[model samples]
Target: MSQPEELLDESLRAITERTVELANPGSGRAVAALRRLTARRRTPALPVVVVGEVSRGKSTLVNALVGQRVLPADRTVTTSTWTLIKHGPSLAGQATVQCGDGTIETVPVNTVAALGTYLAVDGQQQLEDLHGAGARCVSMVLEVPSPLLESGLQLIDTPGVGGLRATHRQATLTALAEADAVVFVIRPGEPISASERLFLAEASEQIGTCVVVQTHRDQTLKAKAALDADLASLTDRQQWCALLGDQERADRVVAYFRDVKGISVSSRNALLAQDEPPGPVRDTLLRSSGLQMLTEVLQHDVVAARRRVRQRTELQLVELVLRQTRDRTRETVALLSGDAEAARILEDRRATIGRWVAHGGDLWRRRYRAGCARIPDELQVIVDRRCAELNTDVGRQLAAMKPTEIEKAMKGVLGLPAQVFTELLTEVDTKIAAAAAGVRELLERDGLAQQAHQTDDDGVTFERLGDGTFTRASTNLSVEDLKHATLGGMAGVGIASSGALVLAHAGILPGALAAAAAAGTAGGAAGTGLAATAATIAAPIFWPFVVGAVAFVAIHQVSRVRARTREQARTVLATVREEIAGTALTRALDAAKEVGRMVEEDIEAGIRELHDEADRARRDLADATTLTPAARLARISDAEDLLARVEDLRAEAAALAGRI
Candidate 1:
């Protein structure tokens, strides 16, 4: 490669490496496509596409350019598919067929006419046949030993469709999109059609260089004059004239074309005299055909134009990578910081849960204590009534009762007050439900109701009581009776329901009553001893006095036992009430704390994930920035020396173009 070509390759290689790295880091589909494009630069092929309407001698022009009878050139629509002709040691051809299953078949090209069987064109098979047969021709490749092909120029002979059919127009436009330069062929006798003009306009936009070829100049002289007049008129238009610029430049262009008759050529005459000896006839035909001048134009001006296209394409690819990298970096940074509105919403939720834990605790404590205060008095009344009934039963049956019957009667009286305690506990559960409702109301007012009830299959919801997370229905305390009330289970009851009360156990009343009864019986024995001592002190004179003292002692013992039992029952009931109230308040407070903790953790995790993504994006941006065209140029050793060498090479190429 020449020095300029080597430098260009170095720059493109640097870009391709950087693009591959970005794609490796999971940059999406656009980056992958860009990588493919950059890789293609390593063996860059400049395509010089030949395009025109059907029967315009485009195939003949391609064959003439290649100096071979390789391409099929006939009056009929012989060139059906896109034919790519490039340099090789010997003449060879191949066809690539795309099958319906996405498989491809690479077959040797035996004859040019076989292409019509796979491709669709005028006078060939229907276009739909290719689809129906589950196969279609993609492209035909021709490798020939031609000097022009060996100069790194690939000639493309595109099918002529006149831009009328949508598929044909698309195929033509696609070829144009990939062309570095274009050769538009027109017959001398015919005027440019609207479709041809449109094709030229679009081709001009995609390709930097375009040369028009007017074929069949050996026809009638009058037709040739009319064609020249048409060319002059077309050249006057700003669209065509702007390509030549000011009057001075226009004059130079007109002078150059005057010698060649406005790029008018006779392919027929040129082909016939290819092997003829040098004589007046050969010289005159060659000169009038304008093929020699067109060859010089392609060798110099077209080659420089192709180089310019390569440079521009490389520059565009670099810009695209930089733009995508910058955009991704910005997006990641925004994610790390988070959305202002969503962050505010999370903060508000945190603050609300915090406030509920603080103030709601005090409110719940007050409600709980007030509701429980009435329980002690209600239980005392039940105890007193049950004791009176027991005393009456003992008075009526004492003389005839057995020891077992008296024991049974005493146990029955102790158990009667259990129902009263159950009622008091039931009332306490109602109060607990009300307190939970208060918590729900507070959360709803602050827009945290949804957050509180959002539960996953693991039952990890915003509202946690103790061990279990509760929904609105399950949190209700009143829905079922408490089977085994414990401090922990009571704490687990969520306060999300208003109408129900959840109790751990209804057995709290019976258990406490049994213990209180046992203590009352022990105290009664002590009271009986004290009463007997007092009775003995007052009576001490006779047997009759002793019997009366015994009866008095019995009555006093019963009264003392009943009084102590009543006092003990009241104390036990009071302690149970206080315990229930305290537990309810503590669980509510804990539930609020748990909710606050969960919210904070979720927010922190989101921020952490965003920060990780941002860090990766920032690193990628740094790497991409380092590989930019300017930065890559700076990194090259002895860049200034190499650049000077490249400039000299470019000057030489420009001089060659000027001479042509």
Candidate 2:
């Protein structure tokens, strides 16, 4: 290899090695991701892609590389899909061509004419088959014996640009993704168009290394001069015109192969004629030296191919590993800090709560007797007034509602007064909740003060502190609180109901008559003896006490179950969180680390192998120096200039690395 190529190989080795180091597991995944991206960018194949406005000899160039004129070169657009061609060989001396998807097929030298049909390029309908197959199937491989070509180098032929129209632009763009380098072909007479410009803008950066091939060598000078004249006419952009070259009617076709490099080649037909018998055309074609020039271009790029592939692949892996690790870490942090778990835990606590309600008839009867004796007359006066007001309001409402109107209104109305009842219950619930809250606050304060007296199994002495000093351990209420409170509330309601019932009965009956009847009943009961009479009157209280006892028992049972459930919930939650933290999260993190390690190792190994291969290539290039005189001259003319360019590339690469 030349000194420039060696330097390039060295720089590539350094980059790959650095990438591997950065990709180490348990370290910076972001750095690894960057390495993978760099590796992808430095892929070995300097892809030579064929791009043009429709019908611009892209497929023809693909065929020429294989030394077989098999590509569809019809008047109509014969090539519809993006077709990739790679190097391959057959048992016969003739070239072998394999379609995409690794299906090998061979064509004899004589059978080259049949390729249009072989590729299904008869018409739009035939081309549709290839288009529908997608890029993978549409691609094919062709091998030719040319020392200038490198291993694993591919030349992609794209769909005719204008023929595909806007409808198929996406497919064209997708095909562009596979190209490592590009060859843009433009026909004579067409202006640099809007669509073409757009394609150039989008693809120029992606296909970083590009060459423009203006086909039909006979018209080369005319095309060049015309393009130059057009560009020069724009006084605003004269530099571009001068850079493109303004010479008219030259013998060679020109190509701006790089950012600041340009080359010219003679007609391909004349060069092919040289291998045939000597003729008048042979001398002229030989002087043009088109074959020799093209060969050098291909060879020069071939040397850099392997390095590019390694660089690109490593970069991709680095990026993937880094992104995955970062995402996993973020997810773990969220799981640990988020409120969702707390909400779930609270819901489980709610499931442990139990409810009970009861009112004893015995307690109600005692309260009923006392209330009746104390307030019978006062209750009678209030009831009479309330009844009078209700009757007047009902009469007025009835008068307002005519018989016909009443029937109509009654269709939608009910005696329940759903709206009013709902509001009334809501108000009652609010007041009860407020009262309960106040009671709880008072109880909590009292309980804190009484904590010194409360004793557990340890029997440790303690002193009550202020409310603020009480911790959650002591502030929690037990099932006993709910049971006692529920029972007390039921007893109060029973007493109030009993008082109302007694007062209502007094208003309905004459007080004097009732008293006389009660006295007579007592006399009768005395004749039967006080024991029998007492038993008869005690039945109501006896049944009330029995009901109260049953209610109390049920409440106790429910409270115990709720308390047990709460305890179980607390235990289960603790175990679940522990298992998740210890096992699931731990395993996930371990797996992530393992994946990172694998990627790091892969990148390291790849870098080492690439470095070794580059060294071997250097030795091989030195040992097998069999270039022709023309090849030697071509190399001398381009090598130093190319080295200078490659040096700049190294510097650029360094700058990019520094930024990273």
Candidate 3:
């Protein structure tokens, strides 16, 4: 069977070539989009990146999947670089390291022990031999003969987060995270911790789908108890996902992650089964390890996820081109037939989109700007109200707690800010939803965008957040660390230090807390795609929150505020609130305004695309109307045939996406 990408490529080339033959100037943008889409580099194999917090049995899980101890699975040895495993003809003993200077070096490995030693990421000294080729190692590839891998599964073992150095956390994770499916390995206890939640949130936003594996099933003799525990934790994740603006991601999280009970696997037990003789006992251990179910689920998700990514990324261009060509062809048919009334239908349709663009753009722009202007102040109100509540909530704990415990109480009591930011998120999501629906009403009503094309790819616009690069918004930090940690850290684009992540790929969960705690600096939002069409934007919210959290802790611990009385703590917090509100929150407000402007720009750009389509139809119809009656009839014949071809291509694009 042809992959969706192959089919899309074939269809796109046909449609684009035919469109070029017609010499349609209006199809230029759509044609160019396809050219750029097809010209980009393609992945040879589907990358299934295995990621998790440190010591969560990620390496062990990879070992069990491949039925070998090729990687160092000892928790003590931190696997720093990525171990990119692909299918090989034989169980070859060799290691290839891609250096930072764009050079690749291969070394012969004598034994499994030698592979482990050469690839170990424990200490700088341990990797000296491996690092001798270059100043930095990009990734290490190990080829192993496995039936599962032979099926085009490229398993990558990355260093776990949480325990990684601050210098390397978010940047490395973001780069390594561009995978078809993320095998998120977790230990038995924490279905997820705080840092792990942040990482998973980022993963869900970036990749859209992942297969979560609960490792170390052998450690617990769980009959139904373990399943229940895992289910409860995942239930919370479902609720959180429901809150995001990308309803598709939320729906997928439910569909993909709904049955995780069977996905629990024990790598140790699976490895032990491999050591056992081929007998009933060994088979029982293998079944008990749950490795079969894990692999099955992983494979199912792998096949399904690649298609989704393809649809969202490149295949979208094919669909868009088909829509543009189809719409234009329809108008051409009517224009050539010389049926003034039939052609009027398209003219009126173009006029509708035109009216929406002219009238709706200003209306939505005003509303969008108003909402954007209101949000910062609303966020400030959320801050002030939540802080007042925090002052009250922490006071009760303060009466019973000692001065030393005040720091702990302050940090814990500030849960109010999280709630406040969550409210802000809800408001932002509402406005974004409203913005998307505002223009879509006309598109859906008239069937101009064909209603089918209204999905995220062609006609849809404005997910709640966009992934834009951010500038520093906070001022109270060292230049080196705070630079990357601002809005993306707050909730803009980049992966922040692993505190809290809220990504539509624009994160506010971490940054909102930073704004609340340290009186946030400016945060940013952008569309990384064409008008940020492909993905949502929200900067990270990690580092600023970390800085703010620490700053809040410091502010709360002043000697006068450390007094036994609850009132003194309240007084100090009151002072801190004023300071944060006047300085940081105002900056946060400015950042939010910037986000609002970007949201308007993206939404308005999408609206303009529709208008441009109508405008092209108008021009084509005008040109055709001027032709002689004999010439017009001849043009009608060509136009009808062109329409038929576009319809076939459109159906193919639809069929490919329907399964995806």
> What is the per-residue lDDT of model 1 for residues 139-179, given as tens digits with 9 covering 90 to 100?
56778888887778888787763332222333454455445
lDDT of 3 by residue, 531-575 (tens): 122111112212122112222233334533334445755665555
Q: Single out the weakest 10-residue window by summed lDDT for candidate 1.
A: 496-505
- Candidate 3 has an lDDT of 0.50
Q: For this target, which candidate reaches the highest TM-score against the unseen true structure?
A: 3
Ranking by TM-score: 3, 1, 2
For candidate 2, give the lDDT.
0.36
* Backbone clash count for every predicted candidate, in the order shown: 10, 24, 36
Candidate 3 global TM-score: 0.47
Q: For candidate 3, what's the RMSD? A: 14.6
lDDT of model 3 at residue 598? 45
Q: Against the hidden reference, what TM-scores do the models get?
A: 0.39, 0.36, 0.47
